[model samples]
Target: MKIKGLSTIRQKLMVFVVLLCGVLLGLVWLLNVWLLESFYTHKVHTDLQRTADAFSLLIQKYETLEDPSQPNGISPDFYSAVQQPEYTTMLLGKCIEIADANYNCLLGNHALSSGQCLLHPARTTLFGDTGLPSWNNKNVLAYRAQTLADGDMYFTLNGQNGMRQMVVCKNVADRYTVIVSTDLERIGQAGEVIGQQVPLIAAVLLAVSILGAYLFSKWFTKPITELSHAAREVAKGNYQVRVREPENADELGQLARDFNTMAAEVGRTSELQRDLIANVSHDLRTPLTLIKGYAETVRDLTGDDKQKRTDQLDVIVDETDRLSGLVNSVMELSKYSSGTMKMEPVRFDLAQLCDEVADRYRNVCEQNGYHLDVQTDQVCMVKADPDSMSRAIHNLLSNAIHHIGEDGYVALHVKPQADGSTRVEIIDHGAGISKEDLPYIFDKYYRSRADAGKVGTGLGLSITKAILISHGYAFGVDSELGKGSTFWFVAAAAEPEKSAEA
Candidate 1:
């Protein structure tokens, strides 16, 4: 089913803009989550490595103060390092023990009931058969690796708080090694601050994305909405609907210009159609009224002269014929306007067509005392509907003959132009049209001053113009006041062999 009113352009644009905003907001949410996770994870890992390095350095300094050959005890510097005010020692409040490689405590006792120190078990297990470090296993993360530079193992311990954590451990050395650690609560606190702000950051990003989408949509559719409103006004028959386009030659501005041009042309055509109907109605009614009156008079004559009756009958027949011709022209113009006129184009010598048209009007010109001149020096085989083209040529010729005054001459000229096209021109030495009326001479019922009192229904030139336009030929009239008028039409060069070659 077709959607009512959904086909309108504004609705489509609104939907597109809203959907675009939704998509952008969604992508912003996803990107924020990813960036937040990456930043926090990276910061946490760096803090952990730093904590482990610091503990390793402190232990190495303490080991330096102890004896190497005998069992080394806790150094004086180790006690001093523990007493440092700025340091955070997990070993301070927590009970711990110092142990040898054989799991025997060499320092003062802080052992458990299992005869193993709580810290000792953690240390032994970290380097023992499990092949994994157990730095207070449940509450910690640790790693024991043989150092690449010295081939000595180092044990590291870590704990996470919020999104960050720190690691601490002892590095294995040649003669002595010591254990140390630092609390990661500070780094973890900083990580927690960042994690807590994620939602707020994500909200800001979403808002920005939505705002950006809205602004872009507004920018892009500004001209489009103007065009839509203009189109609507045009639909209401306001052909003056015009958009103030930007002076720049952008696509949207150019589209507005084209639309404006189209609307103006439509307005012109509407006025022309109105004039055409009025003139046609007037021309048709006059001849029809004459014929009707003449026939009625013949019928009402009680004792008329036979010759007078015959003359009235003749006038009626002539007026009837004129009316029929006008009607036929109207029908032909309708066919052409409705795109129902069919032209059976064929290859024919255009020279022959012009000659035939000139000949048809020759006897009439001579009877009207107008000398007829035919000028042709070339033959053109053009692709066209011969009947239509011949009619066009005959129209100009007949018009010239009718306008030529006594002792005047009408000339029919046919020749090829430099542009590979053939032109047929009909010129008359008679009273011509006014400059003001020449522009509308091809319109139905149009009559020049030279055609005054002539029995023309005024449809021949119009029919000729329509026929020529439909054939895609060029036709026009040039007139000068008092001198004469010339009507000309051009036929394009095409297949000389046959018009049916297509």
Candidate 2:
């Protein structure tokens, strides 16, 4: 079953961290509870062996003593070494006995002061052996036999008083055997102490782990939460909402940067959408208003006058055509910008296309006292979508006409370059674009301050850009304020095929 609490990143992170800490602490607690006694026993055995070795070294140093009747049968130097802090601390509270090969006590601690010396049996027996009656305690006899057979042995023995003792025995220097014993009560005390303190340590560690997990979860999930809130704001059409960028070079930081970039693009598109709606509405309403008003005028007043009636009807027809053209332009721009328009490229004469487009504007140019110039000499065959390229050329020419006022001229030039490319340019002597506006001149719905009152949708140049780009043609505009503008596009020149031999 899916638990809601563990669904989020923060919750899951906290759960994982807590579980990890819990597993570590639980392992430590188990080791302390189950293995503490064995660990302590091993340590005690190691200490016993170390002490035995030190005692053996002292014995070797004093083995040549002239008189064996000295105090404790050891030299003053051996006594001094045993009384030193290193040996005294290791043997403290433990019974130590050093005996000769004949079982005669050479040196001993307080345990030997009772006149008891550890003796080795002539024939040793294993532990739990029923046939041998060697030492009074079978465990002591078994351990003694093991020490003799194995050179050193560690074991636990029960004294006659029923107290348990841990013992270690080792034969040293080929003459003396060193035996050390300690009460098993200290190990029991340590086990009890560990049992009491483990829970407390675990509780303290658990509390610290909980705090650390919470802080880490908060730090890890903070960016995701911010991104979620910003996404919600964007869903509500608030494109201005921005998330703070993280300074780290990790994935979350990169995600934050990407989110900010997407938000900025969304904001820009939203602004363009608003402008498109406003501009389209304005353009549509004007022609619509003109068509409605002119038709009503023809019906109300010019019905009887035939000449006046024709003129009013013509105004209505022109306004209707203008509205239709505007709608079609909007549709075409959308098609090109949305990448839905299919390009059908064929080898076509660029010079011929320019001539045809200029011929269509010949009457308008003459009527407005504007000169239309077409400069081309070569065939300049290029591979491009004929219909779309025609539209782009028409739009450029129309744009030039709109910008260049009465008495101004529009020039169309088709030139072939040495690199097997064709260049088509439409030049107009008009109020040129400013440096600040040149960069965004081809943006949708963009209008310069000078062209704000002009009659044309601002999508002409943008549509031209999209059309040329789809055909893989390089197109741009160069303009200087008050010096005219030149808009041009370049297309690859198609090679003419040679005639086949018969």
Candidate 3:
């Protein structure tokens, strides 16, 4: 068995769709993560601002009650006002010339030693050493809060275990620092869960896609499969195998149309072949019947009277010759049909060959009391097989003589063609062949039965046509019912100059 290559179309399509879907999903997920991060940052900032507002209120009350002569440490009221379920608060000095790296926390509910305000990557430029930077680096507010005396109270926040805190400071003189934070690690864990689920979803989708691909491939190749089987049936001489049409009218439809045409041609050719065989059988049997009857009569019933015996013998001889000619003609036609005829090139004189051919039929015409008309100049030279060329001319002359009635004339003529070739025509002034029979006159065993009395096996013109064709000459017939038929052939020049040597 021949091993064809495995199909790749399904694999290619699966890979393409899978890659496209994956890229699209990846882009959407990445966009979702970025948007969520942005929301998270915003939530953190808002929580920090809320804590700062409460701390500012408590600090204002403290300032109103404080004595300027001696500053008091942070009162408990400041931390209490900013306290939240998830936040811490601290009170730093309101009036102290804060050094480059200062830490003066006055009070705290729970504060780290680091006097730093809450900061992420975005805020790291305005607080002391051990302090997270202020929110905006280019602001005079951040600069004053970090460098000037009685600067902003600094708050540092740390997220509680499983919780987050936000730290907020109100202004440069406020002694309260508040921190607030929220749990954001839970969001990361949720994303991990989604990431783990993606491949499982892809696997499920791939399984469905594979099933779909298999079904589609089978469906696509189905028509071709049916066509192949139909062709096999047609080869078995069934012309009725029309393709069962599917809903699709694509290339397969055209193939079906072509297949039907091929089957039709095959069926028609087979019928013609059968008809030809029957015709050939009938054609041969008629002459055999005549010859056999004439032979048996001369042998047994007809007395040995010289004239009667001669006439009967002549009939038998003529019919026998006709049978031989018919058989030879059929053989030649079969050779032509089988493409076994060999073509040969040779040099010979055309006019001499025509003269010889005319002489033979002249005898026949004289014996039958008909005029033999020969017309041509001498030396019509051409390049053709002398034997086949003579046979072609002889067949034409014989046909004319055979058809010419008593006192009727048979004419043989040779002339030069425009293309350095010679044309020979044989004409008979007898009952002419019919128009309908003219086209198939050269067909094997085709005879014009308009005259039922006509003899011979009906392969005369067929053999003549084959002989001329093998020599690359052209031949055809022209006739009217009463005007007789002209059978003509043109022979190519035998290097007309070279004929001088011959």
Candidate 4:
């Protein structure tokens, strides 16, 4: 299913980022809710166990100094050490109850006056016992008391009044059993306070994350947005619009650069289309006007005169042939450019082909007082479609003929390169193409101002370009404004045995 409003990349990115943030925040909340109280409970039990262990060690030490004369089976110095500031600090949030095997209280520290300690219960006197059970649940107390009695050195218990207590029942030197108890309600209260603030903190963090997500999405999708806008402008026939190319060597930057190139090519093509219309209209109208005017002359003025009528009729035929040639060139160019013109490549001597084509053009060049020179010192053989290649050669020869120098000199050469390729060149000495016009010389319908009034359609070079490109041959032209131009194409050399077999 397609979702609305998130059709663009920016919206989808924002939603994805927000969802990621929410998932992380949810995990943090879950850990706090499920594990925070347990963590606090574990810490309370650890402290109580350490206090009980410390008191047990002290009782063992007092055994060495036990004089039957000392009261409570402990020396005065041992009692003072038990009440030291550091030792008392360990019992800040806790109560310590030391008792004999008969369960008579021997020492009580930090006990509440309201009978809070499970073992001591009251502090009125050394023998104080309220006769009230310290545990609200007798079943719980009985189970824990049995566990301690079953040879367990120490045991911890939790009472219903939010208290946790640790009991070390080892009679050290047969003197004292120590009980250490701490209230766990403070840990519970701290957890509750943190729980209350979670929602507010989460809300603030979520808001910040959402805003950051929006900003990040906007930054990331800026290029795509510009490209889309440029595309729309192009669709509306504004080919000049372009997007800013980014400097980073990423896919998005490559896309922007390619888009700019495409826009430039499209703009050039659009301009060429306009040129095609103008050039075709001009070329077609000249011959058509001649044909119509001469046909009228034959019908109205030269009908009764044999010589004049024959001449007029011949002119009409020539003009009609020119029209046919123009139409044929246009159709052939379309075929070559569209890649519908198939090639039947076979190995042939390029030098021999150049000689044959130059020979064909010799009569036309002589009649026009132009010199056609052909120099082929070596037999350069290549594989290509013969008919298409012949047509390309004819076009280049015609182009050179029209643009030859005042001395009427044009040369065609066939040379074998050091690499396994053959280069064919047609050179003309007429007013050569400028550097500016050389780049567009092979573009269809592109005619430099120098050759604007030349005799043929401007598609000859373009047709040659398409033909060479189809054969995978490289072709180029080198020219200076006053030094004339050399149009050439290079084709890979083919083996004679392969040609003979083919």
Candidate 5:
């Protein structure tokens, strides 16, 4: 059978938590099982050594009590030595035997037999072939015999009554040797107790960890889930969908904020796309309708009258030209905006270029009863793409001409700044752009309400902006609701020597 793996983050997290808890608990169990016995054994050995030292000190005191002047007899206080807690605890439920140099029991808990020494026959037989000091001597305990013979305290392990025991031996002032013994089985029992409780404790901890992991995974993935749903809605073109922002200051929160920003931008772009289609359709239909209607009128009725024929044909030609200009402007804007237009900048006379661009509209201005004024105090040499710069100035002049009515004047001003830059301004005395519409004037296919009946595509200023921007020139417009507007741009001024020396 195939096993299904954890598919969700919650399942994965819970499993991870359980595994972590298990590993930690297993380590604790291993430590208890492996090292616990040795640690306990070492502790017991230390306690036995300290008890032997204390007993030796007591023996030394008792020996001092027997004055050398009357050395034939000794009076030892065995009662006080055995009463000590360290001595009592070390001897509890264990075999302890103190023997003198002649192997007679000097002081012990039990009474000696008729000829019995400190080492019982059975214990002596156990140590007989062990190569210890007691292998030949049957009186002293094996460990005590070794300490007396070498003057070095030591311990030994041996099996006694089906339990392991540690025997520690120390000599006391050459008068007596003390042997302390304890069963090591109690250390194993303590380990067993710990081993029994580990599973229960681990089970409790694992349960708590699993619950915590579930809640944590749910909380963590909540925002991501909401973002997923929002993205789906956006894919379905419902750009209004927005998720509640997460309160966290982490990467997830930042992702949510960025997602919202993307949605807002996409919504705006969709709205603009719809607006573009409607505007282009309207603009195209108007010119096409006029051209078709005028051509039919000329063919059906105006063909017989010379002035009528001329007027209708002129109207048809004008509409055709307008349509051609609209298509061309659309293509030109697309080229510039898509970065297909190349820029080749050179030093040129800004004032001269403005004069030439203004003069191109002189005939039309005079016919329309408008005056063209050019102002330049000196030659302002600037670095810019000459052809694109000329096109930008032409578009600005065209825009001004369209806005300025009969008897209104359009002025072109070129000024050189002290910072080695040139500023060119095109001013028109016409109904100015509103504050609301001013910001969007340079947006593609955007036209202000003041320009409702204008006879050109709304891409002139946008194309001009793109061209100037590609040249890295600064450009903007300033206008009030009723006061006339001025569109201006700045270009870096060429060095005086470059202009003069050339």
Candidate 6:
């Protein structure tokens, strides 16, 4: 069964704390009511027993200093020792007596006037009867004395001066009997005081507990509450909302960090989605308009003129091919992103591959008054998917041609390293990429400012990055403003096949 008003963590935490404090307060009250008095009585008994034991040891040590004039049956030195602060404190609020085997009052006869002594009856009516059976009773004394003589300690409870008292007796030096008495009335008094103050203590504790619980719950749940608000905002398409991260390295802090990262990604994806729509619309509308315009020209104007009709039809075919290329780029990127495009790796001369890709761009560059230089005469063997490698090289070449510098030059270099690896580079003497754009230049939808209105899709470099990454080849770019850029990758070389010279 669910209770009301506990839907949030704060409410649940407060309730848990309240229940905890209640259980603790109940335990304190129960201990005070049920076990406190007995515990105090037992403590008093233990204290009296320790006093008796201390007196026995002291008496044994001074048994040789007998003095008939001293009521304690010890000399002045023994009496001075007993007068020290420690011994005096131990003897406070307690009556002690010592006796020989003949039942003589060797010590504590002064207690008779105060009526706290069990061995002697009260001499005055001021303190009334002790109501103790062992009070000046010979039979009880004989039995207790005999038990002490047998090397065992003895203790009993009895009424003294209208209050209960605990008595501990022990044999000292096998010659003297030591008896220590302390009243148990203080135990009763303490229990009564605690019982009276219990309600007040419980009230203060409950108030403090509730306040602390509230503050703690608020502090602990603040981040979570903010995160909830941020999440709701994100659901409503407000991806810019972010929550403050906590200082701790705990799960809450990690969740906050992850949430912020996810929010940033979502925001980026949303921006990319918008960019994709705009770019695709612009790209498709031009070619589609061209195809429609040229088709109408062929239908209406170039009817009987075969030469003009074929030319117009050829324009339509080129525009259609451009549209088809855009579609193919999108589909290929999707395949690469989804990990569904399988690679067929083989050993081949990397330098030869570079030359072949450069050859395809040769006439285009020459026709556009741009130079295509292929500096790959070395035979560097490498193992990789040749088709993907060719695509990567072609994309780089195309990107360079589009951004070809005023000098109208682009170069491809394939250099063999001493480690038997091949380093391939595509250099364009065009306006270079900015450092700010370098880190994300290869992202799926990212394009540098320099390539803002370029003719190609932005997915070229991203597809190249995916291809190289899948092959586990190391690739990077170096560029400076107005100095052009160099894009490169290193491919591990495969062993060369045996020559026919042997």
User: What is the alpha-carbon lDDT of model 5 when measured against the actual structure?
Assistant: 0.75
TM-score of 6: 0.66
Residues 1-502 of candidate 6 have per-residue lDDT tens digits of 4769689889999999989999998898778876888787778888878877887788877775458786544687876776677776777677766666755444452232235655444332221232333344684467446755576555655654456656677876667777767655656567778888989998999999999999999998988998999999999999999988888899999999999999999998887788778778888999999999988887888878999988888888998999999999998988777778999989999999999989998889879888888899889999899999999999988888877899998999999999999999999999999998887778776777777776766889889998988888899999999989999999987867678996
Native RMSD of candidate 5 (Å): 10.6
Superposing all C-alpha atoms, what RMSD in Å does each candidate have to the true structure? 11.8, 10.4, 17.2, 9.1, 10.6, 7.3
Looking at candidate 1, the ten consecutive residues that score lowest on lDDT are: 140-149
Residue-level lDDT tens digits of model 1 in 152-227: 3323334233321223333445332233322223433544676667667657765776666567667777888888
**Runs of candidate 3 exceeding 4 Å displacement:** 1-319, 336-344, 367-371, 404-409, 429-435, 449-453, 496-502
lDDT of 3 by residue, 62-154 (tens): 563223343333234533443443323222211111211222333222222233323322322112222323322233234334434453343
User: Which sections of candidate 5 miss by over 4 Å?
Assistant: 1-202, 246-249, 302-307, 349-351, 362-383, 404-424, 428-430, 452-454, 484-486, 490-502
Write the candidate numbers in order of decreasing lDDT: 6, 4, 2, 5, 1, 3
lDDT of 5 by residue, 1-502 (tens): 3227987666776777778878988899888966899888888788777767777777776664332343322343445455667666655545555667644444443221222223433232210122334322553555555677777465555544444556667777666777765555666778889989988888888888888888888888888889999999999999999888778779999999999999987997787678678777888899899889988998899899999999989988888888888889989998888899888878788899888888888899888778888887678888788899999999999898888844588999999898989899999988889998887788877778776655556788989989988887899999986678899999886756534565
270-320 in candidate 2: lDDT tens per residue? 877887788888888898898888788888988899998898888888988
Q: Work out the TM-score per prediction.
A: 0.59, 0.58, 0.46, 0.67, 0.59, 0.66
Residue 165 displacement (Å), model 3: 36
lDDT (C-alpha, whole model) for all candidates: 0.63, 0.77, 0.61, 0.78, 0.75, 0.79
For residues 271-368, write the lDDT of model 4, one tens digit per residue.
Answer: 99998888888889899999999999888998999999999889988988989988998999999999999889998888888898899888998898
Candidate 4's C-alpha runs over 4 A off are: 27-198, 495-502
Off by over 4 Å in 1: 1-19, 35-259, 302-304, 402-409, 417-420, 429-458, 478-486, 496-502
As a TM-score, model 4 comes out at 0.67
lDDT of 3 at 427: 87
